[model samples]
Target: MDRSANLVSFEKIRKAAALIKGAVLETPCLPAPRLSQLTGADVFVKYENMQVTGAFKERGALVKLDSLGDDEKKRGVIAVSAGNHAQGVAYHAGRLGIPATIVMPVLTPFVKISATRGYGAEVVLAGNTLAEAKAEADRLAEENNLVWVHPYDDVHVIHGQGTVAMEMLAAQPDLDVLVVPIGGGGLIAGMVTAAKAINPNVEVIGVETTLYPGMWGAFYGKEVRCEGATIAEGIAVRDIGEITTEVVKKAVDDVLLVSESSIERAINAYLTLQRTIAEGAGAAGLAALLTDPDRFAGKRVGLVLCGGNIDPRLLSKIVVRELARDGKLVSIRIDTPDRPGTLGEIATVIGDMQGNVVDVEHHRLFLNVPAKGATLDVSFEAFDRPHGERIVAALRDRGFVVRYLEIGDRMD
Candidate 1:
C-alpha cells in the first residue's frame, strides 16, 4: 500500500459530523490538572470512555451503519474485533434493527465479549488471536452474504471516527498537541485528518506499545512485525490499514512507542487519581505523555481516552503490577537456620523498618539446605523502594542472608 498523503477533506468530516450528530454522544473534554502538574503541560483528556458503547468506535460504527442502504442492512453485518469494535458494531446494529454477527478472538477480554453479546449480536469465538479471528470473519462474511463492517480500513469508517477530533477541537480549539492511540490506524487517521484540516499547526502524534508498534511501522517504513503481549491490546494490530496508513503518513507528526509498564501505570493512575476507568488502549495517550513529559511540557495538549472495556480480573492484575512497579510491593527470599524464632526475627526487622508483611512461604524439604537451614520467601509492602531496601539491609546486618526476588529490574 502506498503511504502517500490521502486526507479525508474537512468537508467530508463535517458531513460525517452531521450524519452522526444525534446518534452519537458528544463526549466531554476533561481538564487533566494532575497530569498537567506532572508533565508541565496543560493537558485535557477527550473522554471517549463515556461514549454510549464505552468507546469511540461507536462514532464510526453508527456512521457506517446509517450510511448502508436497506439491502445492506437487511443482509446483516459481520465485524471482527478483539473487543471495542465488536461492541460498537453490535450495539449500533441492534439500535438500527439490523442483524449482526461478531467474530472475536478467544483471547479477547471477557468484558468485551460479554458486552458484544449483550448488544444482541451472535458471537462467534473464532481463534486464539485477533488475526485469525479476522480471517474467519472474512470467510463468514463471504459464506453468509453479510456486509463487512471493518474496524478501521474503509473511508466511511475513517470519516466516522474523525468526529472525535471535530468535537474535540470544537470544545477546545487552542489544543496545541493531540496524542492518539493507534490500533490499525483508524482512530488516529481520522483524528489527524480532522485536526489538520482545522488547525494544520496542531502537532498530531500517535502512541503505540513498544510490543506492537503498528503505527510506527506504517510511519517510519519499518517491517511492521511487532508481536507480543501488551496491556493495551485494543491497539495491538499487526497490520496497518491502507487508507489509514496514507492519511497518517501525510498528517501525523510523530509516532512514539511506549513500554507496557508505562501503559499499566497510566491505567492505574487514571483509576486511582482521576477516578476513571480507562482500558489499556484508552490510557495509552496518557502513557505517551508520561513517557516523555519534556516533549509536551507547557503546551495545551489534547488526548483521546479511546475506550473503557476491560475485564475485572485484568484490572486487578494491572493494579497489583502497578503497586509492585512503584516499589510498594516487595518479595524477598531468605536463608536462615532452622532454629526457633528465625521467622519472628525477620518479621521484627521488617516491622522496625516500617514494612508491612503481606505473605510468607517457607521451604524446608524442597530446598537443598542443611538440616539446620531453611529457605523463606516473604512478601511485604512498604512506603517505597528505599524503605524496602532498608528492611533488606537490616536483615543482612543482623547476620541473616537475604535476597530480594523483586529487587531486580526486568530490563536485565
Candidate 2:
C-alpha cells in the first residue's frame, strides 16, 4: 500500500485517540521543574515510557493490530525495528491473538529482543542496521503472505502517534512549543498536525541527533549521510518515511540537529534531576533544549520522553560517564618516581581531602616516562566540580605531575 499519498488529518488523529483509548496507557504529561531550571525553558515532559512496552510505539502498534482483519490477523503481522516498535507490535499483537514476527538488526540490544520474545512474538535477527532488517522483513512478509505493520510510514501509525499530542494538550493547554524527536518522522508528523490544529500559534520543532539527520535532511531538502553507532540508536534511521516526510514538510516549523554529547547530557539530566530513565532518542527533545537553550528560553516547551528501552549496562556506563563529565568522578594519571610510598602519598592526599579512591592502576617502563619514574592512574569520587579541582590542586601542590584523564580523553 502507498501510504505516502494518505496524509493524516487532525480528525483522523482524534479518531485514533478514541479507538486506542482503553488499549494503551495514558502516559503522564507533567511539569519538570529541574529540567526547566537546567534548560532556561519552562519545561513539561510527556512520559510515553510509562507504557507497558516502555514507549509511544504502543499506541501505533495497538491501532494497527486492532484494525487488522480476521484473515490478516490469522496470516500474522510482520514488522522491522531494533527497539521500541518491535516490542510494541509484539506486545499488542500478542494481546489481540495475532501471530507477530519481528525482524531486528543483529546488533539490537538483547534486552529489547528478549522483551519482544517474552510477548510471544517470533524474533528474527537479520542484517546489521534497521534498513537491512526492514528489507528482511519485507522478504519474510512476501514469502509468508503476512500483513505488513510499517512502524512509521502507515497512516494508522501516524494517527496513533498523534494521540500523544492530544493527551498532552488536554492536560496542559498552555504550552507554547512542542519539541518532538524525529527518527522516521512519524511522531513529529502526528504531533505537529495535532498541535497546529489545536493552537496554530504553537511552534512545532523537530529534533534529530547529529549522527542520523534523516528527518532533518528530509525537512530541509538536503542529502546528508546518516551513519554512526550513536547512543540514541532508537532514532538512528538512515531513511525517513515517505508519509511522514510529506506530513513533516507541510507542518513542521523547524528541525534542530543535536550532538551526541547533548543527548547524553539530557539522558543524565532526566535520570538525576527528574528521577526518570530516557534512552538516547527519548532524550533528543531535551537535548535540543540543552544545546540551544537560548532558542527555547522563556517559552513553555513540551518534550516527549519517547522511550526508556535502554539496556541496563549501557545506562550504568552513561551515568558514570556523565558523572565524570560533571566532575563528580575523576580519573587522573600521575607520573612519580618508582617508589612504593609515592602511590600511598597521592592516595593519602586524596583521602585527607575526603575524596574516596575508586580505582588504581600502576604503569612502569612507559617510553614517555623517565627511566626511574613510574605512572600511576588513580580514579576517585568527588562531591562536585570544586571538590575535584581541590583534589587535583592538592596533588599538584605535592609536586607530582598530575594529568586528568577525564577531560583529556573523551570517547567520540
Candidate 3:
C-alpha cells in the first residue's frame, strides 16, 4: 500500500513545513553520549520537548489552525485532548487570535488544566476518558458552530507532525532507525510517512505503553485490552484514529509495547543521564531501546523526546522509586528492646556506616512485638547496594533483628 499516494503525501508534509516554519520551533537533533552508552546504540535525541509548549504537538496544532478559513477561525475551534494537544491548540490559537475551546478529561492533572487555561483556551472538564471527552467536544462543536480541530486523524495535522521527521532526517540522514511514541498514532504515522519517503532504508518503530496498545492492537488485528492508570497518560488511548490506523498498516514497520516500570526507568535515565526532563510518553521510545538493546545495538538510532510536561510530583516519585530500585535508597525494620539506647545504637551504626537517615518510625503497639520490644522502621540513603548491605549486616552483628523492606510493603 502506497500510503503517500492515498493518505498524507510527502509533498503535503513539505508544504506544512513551510506553513509552520516560524510558528513552531525546529528542535535540535543531537547525539546523546550517555544514552548511547546505556543502550549500546549510537543514540540521537530529537528534542521536541524543547518547543515553547514543551511538546511537538504545537507543530500540528498550528498547521491545522492556519488551514481554517477566515469565517471558521472567527467561529473558533474545539478539540479533545488529554493535555499536550490541549496546550498546543490553546497556545497557537491564542497567538493567531482564534478563540479555542478544549475538552479535557476530568481526571487530567491540575498542572495541564492550569496550563491550558493560561494559554487562553476555555477548558471544559468532561468525561472520565478521552473517548467520552470527544463525544462532548463533538456535541459542543455542533451546538456552537465551532470548527473541529482534531488532535489527530486529520490530513493537515498529520502533515504538520511529519515535519518532525523531515527535520530529523535533515540533521542525520544516515540514521538506521527512528523510535517514536504512539497515542492516537498521529505522530508515528506522520513520522513514518516522512521518514520512509526521505530514506526508505531507515526503520520506523512505534512505541505504546502496555496499558494502552491501541496502535499495536490495530496493526496486528488482535483484541488487546487497553485500560489502566498509566503514568504515560498522554498515550493512554483506548481507540486508535481511523486515518492513523490506515497509515500505520501501510507504513509503520513495527510497534512495541513497554511496561510501566520500564517507562519510569527511562524517564529517570533522561533526567539523570541526559540532564533533561522527559514525560512518560516522551521516554517511551527510549524505554523500547532499554527493553531490547540487542535489536538496535551498534545501529544509529534516533529517539523523539516528544513531550516534557509531566507533573512535578509524579516526576519526583519516579525519581525516588528509581533510587530505591538502584539501592541508593533503602528501608529497614529493626526489632529491639523498647529502650532509648536501642534507637540510639541503631542510628549510630547507620551513621557510622556513612548512611543518611531519611525517616524513622517507632512501633510499640504491634501484637507480634513483645511488650518490652519495639519495631523501628528506618528509611535511609545509601551510596549503593553493597553499602546498604554492609549497613544491614553491621546492624545484625550488633544482635538486632533486621528485615529489609520492599516497595509497597505493608506494616500490618
Candidate 4:
C-alpha cells in the first residue's frame, strides 16, 4: 500500500478487519437517544469503550504486532504511551509471547501503569511528560535491539484503527456525520480514510481538547504549540504523528476544540444520560457534538466513545463536581441562638422544604457570633437550584439569617 497518498483505502481497511478478527472486540454502535434529544440530531454512539483492555488501541496494537517478521517479534517490542497505548501493546505482545517494554511518564495515572504491568509487560517509569518518556523509549529500544512501535505513525496501526469507520458505516450506513477524537490523529485519520471510501458525503470532523491542538495545527500548516492540562488525557499529544498529519490534512473536514470544562461535563453527561462510562479522551467526540448541536441537528451523526479506563478517584471527583453543577448539592451556614431548639428549627425548615440533609455541624467557638449565638453548617441535596433557593427563602422567612457557602472559584 503506497500510503504516501495518506489514505488507508477500503481495501486495506478490509484486510485489517480480517487480520484482526478474533483478536479484538467488534465494539458495538448503539443508539444514543438521550444525546439525540440533547442535540436534536439522530445520534448513534460507537462504543469503543467495550473493546478488549477497555479501549480501541488494542485493535491497532494487535494489528501492528501481527505485521512484525519473526526476527522483529523475537527481538520484542517497545512503546511509549500515557495509558491506552501502553496497555494495548502490553496485552497484545503478551498474547503473542513477545517480550514488551513500555515506557510511561512518571505523571501517568497509577491505574494505567498498573493495568499495563498486569498484562505481563515490563513497565519503565521514566520522564515527567509524554514527550520525555517517548525519548527514553527510543533510546532503550535502540539499546535492546527491540522494534519500536510508533503509536500513531505506523501504517499497520492506522490500518487497524481504520476498522472503526468500517464498523460504524456497516452498523449505520446512513450516518451523515462521523465525529472522532484527534490526539496523535491515528484514530481520526484512519476513520477518515474508511469513511470517505464508504460514503464521500459523510462529514468526518476531528474533535480535540483546547489544551492540545496538534491535529488542528497540522491541518492548517501552522506552528501551534499543544500545551496545558486537559481532562482528555488520552489525546493529549504534544506533537502530532508524521503519517497521520498528512492523512488528517487530506481527509478531515475541520478540527474542533472543546474546553476542559465541556469535556468533564460531557464525561459526566455520558454517565448520567447515556448510562455509559467514558474516559477523558473517550468523551471528546461527544463533547464536540454537544458544543455545536445545531451544526448536526436533524442529521444522523455518529460519535465514538473511544475508551473507558478512568481511575476510581477521578470518577468520584467528576461525580461530585457534576452534582454541584446540577445544583443538587449545596452547603450553607446559619447564625442561630445557642439554644438546642435552634438546631431543631433549622433541621425542621430543611426537612419541611423536602431537602435531604447530607451533613450538619454546629460551631460556637470560631464564629463572630455572641456567646449566646452559634454557627450551624449544613449540607443538603436539593431537587434543583430553585429548590435550593426555596429552602434558603424558607430559612430567611423564618427570621434565621442564612448564607450559602461558596464552592470555590470554579466558573463552570
Candidate 5:
C-alpha cells in the first residue's frame, strides 16, 4: 500500500479541470461578509452546492465516466453512494448515454433516493450502511458485468475532486487556509493535493463529524468509535480510502472533528447569515470554524460548501431547533387550577406580553397534578430570550407556577 505511488498528481487534476469544463459549472467562490463576522475570519465560500446535481460530486463522476473506453461505457456502470455521488454518476451517465445502476443504503433519505432514480439510474436499496451497500454493489457489478464507478477511491475521481481547490485558489490565491469536509477523503485529498501544489504556504485543513472521524483517526492513529446517527450523515463514513489516507498524512496540515450540534449550528448559520442551504457535511468546514473560531480568526479562510441536498423535512426541523436554541421559540409549563377561566387567564397574560402562542397541551389526570388542578404546556414565539423571559415573569406575577422548558426535556 505505497499510497505515494498512487497519489493523484497536479497534472491529472488539471486534465480533470479541462475535461469537466463547460460540462460542469465552475461554481462561485465569493466572500461571505456575515460568515466572516461570525467566525472572526475573512471567510470565502466555494459554492459547490450550486452544481446541477447540488453537490461537488458531479466533478469527479463526470471525469471518471469520461475516462471509460467505449466498450466499457456500453457495459454501464454501478456505484454505491448514500446520495450525492449516486446522482452525479446517474446524471452524467445519462447524458453520456451510459446506463447506470446505483446501490444505496436502506437508511438513505427518500428525497435522495428519489432524486437518484429521477436521474435515470436504476436504484437498488440494499444494506443498512455504506459498507454493506458496497458489498451488494460489488455483487451486482460482477453479475451484470457492470463497470464499478467508485464513489471516491479511484485516482480519476480524486483528480476531479481536486478541481474545487484549483478553482478556489485561482479565484483567491492568498487564502491562508482551506477547510474541507472528509467522508471517504476524496474531496480533501484532491483539494489538498491541488492547494499545496499551487501554494505550499496555504494550509489545508480537513473536518469530519465527531461520530465518523475516519480520516481523523487514520491521521492520528487512534481507534475512534465511528458509529452514530449524525445530521452530517453524508460524511458518516467508517473507513478511509488508502490513497486518501496517505495524501492526508503527508500533506494535510490538520484534521479536526466537529460535534453534531456544531454542524447543526453551521447549517443554521448558512441559512440565516449567508442565505444559503448547507447540508450537514457541506457545513462541516464552517462547523470546524465555529467549534474553534480563534484558530481561524483574522486569517483568509476558504470553506467548501460541498453539497446542499438536504431533505426538506430535516431542514425544517433544523430551522425550528435553531429558533428554539436562540430563544425565539420557547416552551413553558404552568400548574394552575382546572377552572374554566384558568386557561383564558394564562393565554391573556401571554398575549399581553406580545408572546404568540403556537401550541398548547392540557393535562389534568397526571398523578403529580392535583385532581382539581391541571398543567398547561405552552409553546410560543417571542422576539428574543429577554422577551420570552418577560412573558414568563408576567405569568409568575399573576401567581401561576411557571417553569421554562428546555429543549429535549420530557414533559412527563
Candidate 6:
C-alpha cells in the first residue's frame, strides 16, 4: 500500500497540545543520569507512564473524544484494545459523559479489563487477539450508532500523540534524536511530525520488538514473521497503520529492532536504576540503546517510557530472573546425608558466608538420591556474583556435593 505523507501537520498537533493542556498531564521529559550511564548516551526519559491511566494513550483518546459531535457523544463511543488504549478511551469517555464500550480480547489481562470497566465503559470480551477484538468493536460501533475511536489509525489520535513531542522540545530544546517504540505507529508517527516540524535536523527513530516487526517490515517492503509471546505486548502489533506508515516513512530517520532479552534488561534497569516501572513496550527505546550503545553514544537521545501497566506477577518474575542471571540470586542443590544435623550445618555455613536463604526444598525420597542421602535445593540471595561464588566455595570445602542451578533448570 502506497502511504501518503503529510496527512498530519504541526498546526494540528499544536492545536491538540492546547486542547489537551489541562485535561492531560504534561509528563516530564527530564535527564536520566542512571540511564545515561547504562546506555553510554546523554539520555533523557519522558515519563508518559505518569499519566492517570498509566500510558501515553490518554492524550490521543482525549483529543478524539473532544472532537466528537454532541450527537455522537450522546450516541456513545466504542474502541478495541486489551491494554492502555482501552483504559484511555474508557477514562476520558466517562469524564466527558459519553457512553463508552471497549471490546477486548478474551485473554486480556484482568487488571486492564477491570480498570476499563471501573472507568465506566462497558467491556465486551470477544475473540482471542487484538485483531479479533477489533472486529467485534467495529460491528458494535456500526450496529449501535457509536463513534469508532480507533486506537492508532485516526488523524485526531496521531495529532494528540504528537503533543508529547511538543512538550519534550519545549522542555529541552537541544535533543538530537527521539527513540520511540512503534506498535501500530501512532506514537512515532505523531512524534516524527512534531519533531521534524520544530527542528528539521532532529532525528526520530522507532523501536520495535523483533518478535513483531510490522513497521520494520513495512519500511523494507518485505514480509517478516510477526508472532511471538513478547514481554513488550503493548507494541506487539502485526499490522502498521495506513496513515501512520506514511508519516513514519517520511519523517522517521530509522526503525530498529530489539530482542526480547534486551527488553527484559531494559525493564530491569528501569526498576533498579530509575526506581520506576516500565512496561515491556515502554522500555523498548532503552532496549535498542542497550543493543547498540555506540549508535547513540554522545548524543542527547530522548526515550519515552510509554506505559507502566505491567502485572505485579510478571514484574516480580522479571526482577527475580534478572537477579538470578546477575548471580545476585542463585539456586543450588546439595547432596547431604539424611541425618538430622545435616540441614542445620549447611544452613549455618550459608549464613556464615553471607548467603541469605529465601527458599528450600528437600528431596530425600527421589530416585536421583541415594537411600541414606537427601538432595537439598536451596535458593539464596548473595551480595553479587563473587560473593555467590565464595558461598559455593565455602559449601564445597565442607565436602558436600553441590551443584548450581540456572533459573530455567529450577523452574517447575
Estimate candidate 4's alpha-carbon lDDT, on a 0 to 1 scale: 0.87
User: What local distance difference test score does each model get?
Assistant: 0.87, 0.90, 0.93, 0.87, 0.93, 0.91
Instruction: Please give the range of 10 consecutive residues that has the lowest summed lDDT in model 1.
Output: 403-412
lDDT of 2 at 272: 95
Error of 1 at 326 (Å): 1.8
The TM-score of candidate 3 is 0.97
Off by over 4 Å in 3: 1-5, 408-410
Clashing pairs in 6: none
Q: Name the runs in model 4 displaced over 4 angstroms.
A: 1-7, 367-372, 408-412
When 4 and 5 are scored with lDDT, the better candidate is 5
What does the lDDT read for residue 77 in candidate 4? 96
Model 6, C-alpha of 276: deviation from truth (Å): 1.2
User: Can you give the TM-score per candidate against the true fold?
Assistant: 0.93, 0.96, 0.97, 0.94, 0.97, 0.97
**Compared with the true structure, what per-residue lDDT tens digits does model 2 show for residues 139-207?**
999999999998898888988999999999999999999999999987988888888999999999999
Candidate 3 backbone collisions, by pair = none
* Candidate 2 error regions (>4 Å): 1-6, 365-371, 407-412
Tens digits of per-residue lDDT, candidate 4, 218-250, equal: 777777878776777889999788788888887
- The C-alpha stretches of model 5 lying farther than 4 A from their native spots are 4-7, 408-411
Candidate 3 residue lDDT tens string, 280-358: 9999999999999999999999999999999999999999999999999999989888887888889899999999999
